[model samples]
Target chain A: MAFNTGAALMDALVLSVVSNESTYGYKITQDVRSVMDVSESSLYPVLRRLQKDGCLETYDREFAGRNRRYYSITEKGVDQLEDYRVQWREYAEKVDRVLFGGIDDDKN
Target chain B: MTKTEFLSRLAEELKGISAEEREEALNYYSEYLDEAGEENEEAAIEELGGPEKVARIIRANTAQSAQGAQPAAPKAAAEDPFGAAAQPVPPSSAYAQGGQSAQQAQSGPAYTQSGPDDTQSGPAYAQTAPGAPHIPYEGYEAPRRRSYLWLWIILGVICIPVIIGLLGAILGLIGGVIGMLASLIIGGATAAFAGFGLIIKSVFLFSSYPAGALFMMGGGFLTGGLGVLACAFGIWLIRKGVPFVASSIRSGWSYLKGKVRDLRWND
Candidate 1:
């Protein structure tokens, strides 16, 4: 819960949110905020970078009489997300083993 | 703080960012506040933190990401994202929005008011609302068009006269060679005519006056020798001048061919 959000992690989070459905900036930020303590402003730059990297695509839609830009995940973004997930699983498993190893030993 | 004040401050803080980025940020926050509704405006603003802090975070993130992607983007983004001076914004990553807007934005005003309809709303709702004038992010100036134009003009002015002078020299040398050949032909023909006439005259006079015939024969031989010298001079001129003209023509053709190749390559 208390960890820095590196670029890869941030990319993964944004891609995951966008992978579900095409979402706007604020909504994406809200969804991301549900899991992490991130500044709303920080999310915009991440979204922009992902879009720049071809991991995300944006389109404008009329919502409540105003144009809201929505971001959708690209095929490239899905691939990137898969890579991130694999890496995260490997990383988390290694860390979990070390951090929870003692408890398992005591139980055994 | 009210939403309008908050956004304007954020825009002010984001002065040096590209216009598209500035609009995207502004639109996102404005929509966020609108969704929060009037009752929660102040709370939403507090939750988002100060515009300055938010701007700093945004700028730092963009600069870092740009640095990762391109060698040039980071330099411009890092040098002064907040400075009043305008800087060129690199094209977004291949997947981002249309790159045309960034190019167009640099040529025109950085910010254009969206429209007048939204301003009629409450002050908090004014500016950057669905209908408000788009406050364009300022700070990027396109490269100077006039300077490049002037550079081309200067190069033309310097190069044209030299090319013309080279052409004139080549033509003049060809003309001089032709004139020399014409004079050689005329001189040889006149000497031959005179030598033959003197020889015939000496043969006719030999029976009547032997001393006078001897003088005419000597004169004929001298005239014949002069004609032979003229013929030798013409041959020498042909030997030297033909190669010189041929080489000059070849060099000029090669020079022109090289220039054409260069132009094609440049194109």
Candidate 2:
């Protein structure tokens, strides 16, 4: 939680959340906050940028009397999320090798 | 402390960014606070770390992303697709199932009813046209969709003389400036031409009259160097002078036009 979550991880985190459920801004912040020590305010711009990137598309659904803007992942977003997953796996493995030094071999 | 104070402070910090962007940010935060509800409003505001901090984050993100990258799914994101389609049915999927439709955040802000719709109208972008996203904020309105056609048409009908006068004045100004620079351009060109001519003559005379040719060559170099300098200066003058002269004429023309208009009004 103390380490910096880079933009890519943030995107992955957001995409994974939205990919699970087409949620609104407040809910997305809450969900992201649940997993990581991130501010609720910072996520708006990320959501906006992701939406601009064609990685996310939004639709307004009337909630009670007011409309809540809901973000849903596009095909592009799904592909991006998959890319992020592969990259994250490779990254984590590399970091682990350097930090833990053949600990897998020792355990085995 | 309250949502209104928090939002206005945020808006002030965000004046530099585009209006559409600012409105969307404000609306998002407003709805965000609304979602937090009455009981938890103070905690929500605290969690957001004050509006000033929120605005700074947004501003930094905005500046970072504005470098030539355009929004990709424009029609999808730019317009309210659900509203535009007029399809009351939601874009139902597995994603929709878990969350269900999010309820409206207007439970009660206490000031909701008495507040002007303009002031408290949550993030609802009034789609004024098919493409233009109009946020119903007091300070920002969608740019007026009006053509200056009548003004142009009247000018076309009655201001033929005025147009001619402007053209004539511009031309006369250009001609006078060119006339001033004409001396230098011609002088430089003439000297350059004569210097080249002498250098060629020196080449021809080197075979027949060596001493005379040497003297001619020395003279040629002297004249040639001065000619080139004058020519460079003249061209520089023309380049700098023309725009200066033209702008002056434009200002003078406008001043005269204003005076004439004043006279007509007084009469």
Pick the lDDT winner. Answer: 2
**TM (chain A), candidate 2:** 0.88
lDDT of 1 at B53: 61
Show where candidate 1 strays beyond 4 Å: A102-108, B65-267
- What is candidate 1's CA lDDT for residue A92? 73
- Please write out the lDDT profile of model 1 over residues B1-267, one tens digit for every residue: 999999999999888777887887788788878877789899778766667766755654454443332334323323322111232344453123465345324422111111222121111101121222322221112122334557778998999989899989979987987888877867876787788789899999999999999999999979977886786788788888788978998999999999977854443
* lDDT, residue A74, model 1: 93
Q: B214, model 2: CA deviation in Å?
A: 39
What DockQ does each prediction reach against the true complex?
0.08, 0.09
Docking class of 2: incorrect
Model 1 chain A, TM-score vs. native: 0.90
**Candidate 1 chain B minimal-lDDT segment of 10 residues:** B120-129
Quality of candidate 2 docking, DockQ: 0.09
Candidate 2 lDDT over residue span B1-267, tens digit each: 888899999999899889999998998888888888878988888877677667766765565445322232234223332122222223443124332222112111111111122223222222222343333222222121112345557779798998899999979987886776787778877898888889889999998999999999988887887888788888999789778878997999999999977854443
